[model samples]
Target: MCEANAYVRQDGVEELFLEGVDKVVPMDNQLYLENIFGQKKMIAGTIKELSLVDHKIIIEKI
Candidate 1:
């Protein structure tokens, strides 16, 4: 199962939103991933568009 992870973006601060994620669904640079121990996290990015087709998740990052 694919799950979303949360991120905190602050001014003058840069961080890797997705790194070493276990459940990473790495396609189109979109991650439906989870933590290392199979824990579900809150959705982070602002989703403008979303679609699920052919076992894929397409989203527009805002």
Candidate 2:
């Protein structure tokens, strides 16, 4: 999965933005991130921001 800070730019909608992530995070599925905190400490939500930057994508939950 392409994980990165994807900047969702909407033409006539609300813009979206998220931090460095690690999942495409489907709108219906979800996007979760992990750090030194551990696995269970990750955040899950509907993906919002969807963009492709050099084959990498930034995803955020709705």
How many steric clashes does model 1 contain? 0
Compute each candidate's TM-score over C-alphas. 0.30, 0.32
lDDT for 12 in candidate 2 is 43
State the lDDT of candidate 2 residue by residue for 1-62, as single tens digits: 45455444345444324444554423235544442223322334544434566433433334
Tens-digit lDDT string for candidate 1 (1-62):
44333343445343435433445444444446666666543343443322232222223343
Best prediction by TM-score: 2
In model 1, state the lDDT of residue 8. Answer: 37
How far does residue 44 in candidate 1 sit from its true spot (Å)? 3.4
